[model samples]
Target: MSPVNTSSSLRPSSFLLMGIPGLEATAQHWISIPLCSMYLLALLGNLLLLAVIQSDPSLHEPMYLFLATLAITDLVLSTSTLPQMLAIFWLGPRSISFHSCMAQMFFIHTFSSVESGILVAMALDRYVAICLPLRHSAILKPSTVARMVLLILLRGLVLIPPFALLLWRLPFCGHRVIPHAYCEHMAVVKLACADTTANTMYGLAVALFVVGLDTLCIALSYTMILRAVFGLPSSQERLKALSTCASHCCVILIFYIPGLFSFLTHRFGHNVPHHIHILLATLYLLVPPMLNPIVYGVKTKQIRIRVVRVFCVRVA
Candidate 1:
C-alpha cells in the first residue's frame, strides 16, 4: 500500500517578493505612504510635461522632442514596477510566479538600457546645438530624430533579450523569496541554484561596456560643447549655452550616480546589510524617474511658463 499524500506534499511554485527586505509590516505600511505620494507626483509631472510640449507649436523643436521622449520613458519605467510594489505593500500579495518575475526583470532592464541610450542621444543633441549651431537644424531633422528613437528601441531589444533568456534557463531551486522591493535582474539571479557565472559576467559587461561607453560618449560630447561655449566672445552667450545644458547634466548625474553607487554596493559591499543594498538599488531606479520631470520643468523657461498657464487655467 502507498502512503497517503497530503497538503504538506505540495511543492512551492512561486517566489515571495520581499518589499524592502527586513522591514516590518508596520514599516512597510508607513513607507507606502511616501511611495504613493512620489508616484502620483511623478505621474502628474511627466504627463503635464508631455501635454505642454505636444500642445504648443513653438515647442516642436528637437530639444523638446527629446524631452518628451525622456518623459515617456520615465512614465513607463516607473509604471512597470510601482503598481506591483504597492500591491505587495498593501494587499500582502507578495507571491509572484517565476514567469511573471522574469517578465518584470526583462522590462526593468530594457527600460534602463533605453534610458541610457536616450541620455546619450540628448547629449549629442546638445553638442550639435551648442557647438555646431549653423548645422543643428540640418543635422537633427525630424527624420533624424525618428531614426535615433528607433535606434534607441533597437539597442535595448538586441542587448536585453540574451539577459532575459539567460535568466529563464536558470534553475531556481533554492529559497524563492527575493530580498528586494522589485525583481531586479541581479537580485533574481542570486536566487538561482545553478551556476550563474555567465549571468554575472554578462551583467558586468553590459554595465561596464555598454552603459559605460554611453557615459564616455556623453562626457566627450559635453567636453566639446563646453569648449565651444567658452570660445564665444560674449560671457552672456557662454552663460546661456551653459544654462541650457545644466538641466541635461543634472538629469544625467541623477540617473547615473545612484546607478554607480548601487552597482558598487552590490559587487563590493558584502558586509553591508541586505536591506541597504535593496534600498540603494530601488533608489537608483526610483529617484531619477521621480525627479527628471521636476528638474526639466523648473529649469526650462518655456516649460515653466506653460506649467503656470496650466495651473492658472485649472484654478479659473
Candidate 2:
C-alpha cells in the first residue's frame, strides 16, 4: 500500500480517535450516559475507600494498606482515559496529539502494571496472614509495605518506556486514525507502516512476564492459603479463614477475566465486531474500578462498618 503524507513527516502530529466504530454516529451520545455514570461511581467508590482507610488508624494494617494502594491505582487508571472517552462520545471524534497519545498510553499501561502488582501483594498479605499468622505483622510492617509500593511503581516506570520507544522509532504510514476510544498500546502500534515484529514480540513478552508472573504468584499464594485453611482444627476455623480471602478472590476475578478477554480479542478476534472489542476494552477498565470498593466494602466487615459510620457522622 502506498503511504499517505509520509513525505512531510514520519508520523502524524495528531491521531484522530474514532471512538466506537459502528456506534459512533448514533449510539455514542446514549453510550455516554452509562459511561459517565460508571466513571462517577469509580471516582466515588475509590475515593471513599481511600478516605476510610486513611481516617481509621485501626484499619491501617498491611491488607488495608494494600487496599489503599489498589484504590489509588484504580483512581488514576480510570481518570487517565475515561474523561477523554466521555468527551469523544459526548462531543464527537477527537484528535489527540502524538505526545499526548503516548503519555496516555504510558499512564494506562504503567498503572495497570502497578495494579497487577498490588493484587499480588494483596495475595501475599493474605498468604502471610493465613499461613504465618504470628509473623504477619512483623513481615509486612509499614516500612516494608511502603517499599513494596515503591517497587511496584518502579517496575512500571522502568518497564513501560521501551514500548513508547519502540513505537517512536517506527515510521507511520501517515494514516493516523486510531479506531478505538483511547490510546491502547497495541492499537497504536498497529498504525505503523514498518514490520511490527519487534513491537508485537516485546508487548507479548512484557504481558507474559508481568501479568503472567503475577497470576502465577497469586495462584501459589492461594494454594498455600487453602492448604493452611483446610488444615485448621474445626469447620468454623476453616470457614473464617476462607472468608478473609473472599473479597480478594472476587476482585481478582472481576479484574483478570474481562482484561484477558479484551486482550485476547484485540489480538486474535478478527471475526469479532469492532464495536464489541471497543466495548470490552472500555468495560474492563471501568468495571473493576467501580466494583472493587463495593466488593471490599460488602465482604470485609471492617470497611463496611467504617463506611457506614463515615456517612452517619457526616449526617449528624
Candidate 3:
C-alpha cells in the first residue's frame, strides 16, 4: 500500500516538498534513506544471528531458542512494513487504500506485542536462573517456556483483533492523508470520521496494559535478579549476572518509548513538530530489530563466535 511519487494513486501536492514528515516536504522526502538503511542493516544482522544459532548444536538452550524466535519476529516486524514503506517513499503513490492500511497496522502491532512479551519472558528466565539457582533448570524447563510463549501469543491474538475490527468498522471521511509515514494506530485512528473516543480510550488502556505492565514486570524481575546477583559478594559474579540483561534493557527502552510517544503524540501532541513525530515513528519500528541480535550476541558468547566463524570461513 506504500505508493510513491508517480503512482497517481495518491493525489500529488503541487507545492513541491521533499521531507519525510516535517514542517516542510523536504525533510519527509529525505528521512526515508536513513530509516531504510537501518532496516536493511538490522535485517542482515538478525539473519546472521539466526544462521549462527541454527548451525551450532551447542547453542540449543532455552535462551538461544528464544533468541532465534526473537530474530524471526524481528525479521517479520521489519519486513512487514519496510518494503512497502520504502516503496511508498521512493517509487510512486505513497497512498495505501483503507483495508491495506489497516492490515499493516494490525501486523505492526501484533509482532510488536509478541516481541514485548517475549522480552518479559526472557527477563523472567534470568530471574529464575539467578534467584533460584538450584531450581533454574527445573523452573525454566522447555514445557514452562512453551507455556509462557503460548500464553503471550494468545494474549496478543485476542487483544488486537477486535480493536482492529473496530477501526475497520469506522467510516473514514475525515482527513484522508495520514501526516505520519506508517499506518500506526494513532495515525490511522486520527483519520477516522467516526467518533474515536472509544478507540482512543481502549487503545490507551491496552497500551497501559501491555507496555506499562510489561515494563513494570520486567523491572521487578530485574530487581530480584539484581538482589540475587549482589548477594554474591564477589564483584565478578555481579558483573557477569548483570551483563546478560544490560543489553536487553537497552533494547527494551528503545522499543517501548517510541510506542508511548506515538500514543502521546496522537493524544496530546497535535502541535508536535512533525520531525519529532517522524523520528519517533522511525525509531519505533527501526530500533528493536536493529539491536535485537546485538543484545543476544553480547549475552551469548558462543553465538557471537559462531557468527564470526561462519562469515570468516566463507571469506577463506
lDDT per model vs. reference: 0.84, 0.92, 0.75
- lDDT (C-alpha) at residue 176 in model 2: 96
The full ranking of all candidates by TM-score, starting with the best, is 2, 1, 3
Clashes of each: 0, 0, 19
**lDDT tens digits, residues 1-316, model 2?**
3344443368888999989999988999998899999999999999999999999999999999999999999999999999999999988889999999999999999998999999999999999999999999899999999999999999999999999988887788687999999999999989988988999999988888998999999999999999999999999999999999999999999989888888888789899999989998998889999999999999999999999988999999
Off by over 4 Å in 1: 1-12
Error of 1 at 25 (Å): 3.0
Q: Would you estimate the TM-scores of all the predictions?
A: 0.93, 0.96, 0.88
Off by over 4 Å in 3: 1-19
lDDT string, candidate 3, 168-278, tens digits: 556554456676656778766766665788888888888888888899999999988887888998999889888887877877787887877877887888798866876
Give the lowest summed-lDDT range of ten residues in model 1: 2-11
**Model 2, stretches more than 4 Å misplaced?**
1-8
Q: After superposition, how far is residue 138 of candidate 1 from its true place, in Å?
A: 0.4
Candidate 3 overall lDDT versus native: 0.75
Which structure among the candidates has the greatest lDDT?
2
